[model samples]
Target: MVPSPALDTAARAVPRVRPAPAPESAPPPRRGRRAAVVLAPAGLTLALGLWGIRRQNSMWRDESTTYQVAHRSVADLWHLLGEADVAHGLYYLLMHGVFTLWDGGLLALRLPSTLAMAAAAAGVALLGHRLAGPRAGLAAGVVFALAPAVQRYAQEGRSYALVCAAVVWCTHLLLSAVTHPRKRTWAGYAAAASATCLLHEFAVLAVLAHGVALLSARLPEPLRWAWARAASAVAVVLAPLAIVSQQQASLVGWIDDPGRPELLGFAIPALVGLGCAMAPSAAAGPVPLRALALPLLILPGATLLAVSFIHPIYVDRYVLYSYAGFALLAGAGLEAALRAVPYPKAGAAALAAVAVAALLPYSIQLRTPQSRLDDPMAAARAVRELTRPGDGVLFMPARRREPILSSPGEFRGLRELALARHAVPSGTLHGIELPAPRIRARMLTVQRIAVVMDPPGRPLDDTPQERMKREVLDRSFRRCAEREVRGMVVVLYARPGAC
Candidate 1:
């Protein structure tokens, strides 16, 4: 059977039913706009990232962990990883290099995440343009830049943004391999998938997403097997990290099993992604948006949430790359919507304005400290002003020591009453504290103590150590000066007559 003479020489026969693939349904030409389409949203993301990069110079609990851990010497970092966060070893090493080159404090800490999110926006735009059109691509990129979740993680010091970027670009690479069918392309895809899984093991979920995409596209059997081989290679390469990180899973024991709110979170956005994915695309590529975006948007989050019932590793940020798929669908949906309406250009402009108006308040809120669960800097200020020389400070649950650890010099004048070993040397998040008897003995000698505690009504830790701290404080000391700061309760305790 001879190939159709009208089929372009460059594009391969991706499907037996179709004559050609990539160029078959291309929209009317305004060529050479691909670079601009990718760069535009990326620039917007970078601007949004830099707009309030400092978050009023406040770092939250996780950011504090990143900052302090990344600053450790290589030996200390490696040793610490063996004990605490082996999953984050690569990210910590990357951050260590960033800090070594430029000690810009908060700026250095979070800039990598911001830049990586910008890259993700670029990837989304390129993908949207390939499937829908330049307009859809540009819109998708901008939407990604403005997404509240994207904005939230973009300003943090973490690996999720980088993982998001890798997933988005690798998805684009998957489509490229489908149309072009080159060993180099598949190799790139496998390599990227491996790197993404290395960044965080949860990204293996994206591999399952790609499988859904390939099956849904109904591509040729050869293509499916090729993808399978590539995916298998990724899984094999990731096996070591997966095995090692299994031990680390217990580190996130704090995560609760998915509940009603988790269901609502996945269900609502999932419906929207589905609608947009099913909408018509004016510019069509080799792959269908429904086949690609819907699975990418739905599978990772839903699977992880479901798995949380057994292992409890679900986190919204862990599947942050899902937003790229949503952005792609949204851009295509907007384009299809405008095409359906009269006076398309006017509808597009009006839609853009409406989106900006609706998102402005949330955008403003994203730049503030209140956007996160808690701000450590707010409590650090209280600690700085309250402590006098010769005072002793006690972190009731030990993890409450985060604010002082974040701001190294803040606790200078006060002795750490409960700590037996410092965090860096002990290779722990918070330093190891004394046994219950030792803590009680230390407390008995202090005339004045500053007790750092969690906010009211959080469940108590049922350990002997906590029982000792509470009983000794209640029995021997009088609360003198008490202040409530963001995420913390700082109280001054004194011997019965000292106050």
Candidate 2:
């Protein structure tokens, strides 16, 4: 990388008229450029993550899961992972350590994601700078930081952002190994790749993307085989996790088969990435941006989507690392677009400013609790305000119990009609529920019941016990009052005219 920088610095250091070489040598200027491109977007990402760090003190269903799981005893967490969410076990363990150091509620839960996203931004800058010039690198970092999906996940308390960060940095290592070709570098690549896949099993798809880049670049036989050995080692490391996660595949059973909207989602981005990659400047190097970026941008999503037809496993976040590839191409394309004009640097700055201005509305929207699918914290507040003494509680699909899982104090006054065991005890996210017959009998015992459910138009649970919950509540209890939370519903039901 040092010698590569000299190539760019040689052109810039062509005996400038007024500049002093002592203060402005190649290394110093290069160091300044590196910090400028890397830190600028990283700072912006941190700012975005911090701006609405709390989401008005709201925690969504997923974050609520993270809160409860991370707070669990290590033994319980380990046990729970085997039964479900084995793929995310590594992340849960990481967050457990995070909360151990500083259990600052939402801040503690989410700060790691914020930091991970910032790291991801820095990695994107470095990768772009290595392939193209510093301007392209700066552009790529900014593009990644400003992506709506990146912003959404940056504040999320989940493995996706960490996976994104790990994948980006690991891809950078892969590139480094292409040039440096040392045994130690390959070892680092394997360690990084394994860590990324461990964050989420689906992240192994990134290996396929890396393989494509290696094939397309037409590197020497030794380098190619080294990547294969490294990739093979990563696969070996992840094999156990893959097997475990497959057994837990029901965790993602909620995903629908890919439809027109889903097709369009990948198609639009694929076309744009292809266009940007075709630009002559974007594809100029030993490992050109297009050679890597096109495959990285397309392969993961395409593979996942193609596999989704057989197993229904496609989701945008599952392939979130693909966004890094898109950002790289876009940044290079932006620089190429401006290359024909005079004062290209000025043009790039103006374009970046315009982009910030254009995306202002979306940036503001990303901070709100409403931006998420559901806010369990808001739903908890609804449950707290509506419950009466001796009232029974029910979660329509059982998983709707997410609101009170982290804040069990709210469960104190209300008796849970269907619960047979608590989450930690049962090794489940939502507590296990009684059979349909028992649930029916229990619902009849309470004078009033409070039910937590999904928003209207969301799919209902088709399980028999869930059906019985709805049937008994509707037939035996009359709706007294109801309120809508950001992403869920809370309804109070009374026996006969008790309301």
- Compare the candidates by lDDT and give the number of the best one: 2
- Identify the leading candidate in terms of TM-score: 2
The Cα error of candidate 2 at residue 190, in Å, is 0.9
Per-residue lDDT of model 2, residues 1-499, tens digit only = 3567868889887976895557444467778888999999899999999998888888888899999999999999998998999989999999999988899999999999999999999999888988998988998998999988899899999999999999999998898888888999999999999989999887888888898888998878888899989989999999999998889888888899999988988998889888988776744457988888888889999998999899898999988889999999998888888897898888877987898898889888888887888887777778888887799988887888888897778767888999999899989988799989999999899999989998888888899899999899778889988989888899999999798
lDDT of 1 by residue, 183-233 (tens): 999998899888888888888888889989889878899999999999999
| Cα-based TM-score, every candidate | 0.92, 0.92
For model 2, what is the alpha-carbon lDDT of residue 220? 80
| Residue pairs in candidate 1 whose N, alpha carbon or C atoms collide under 3 angstroms | none
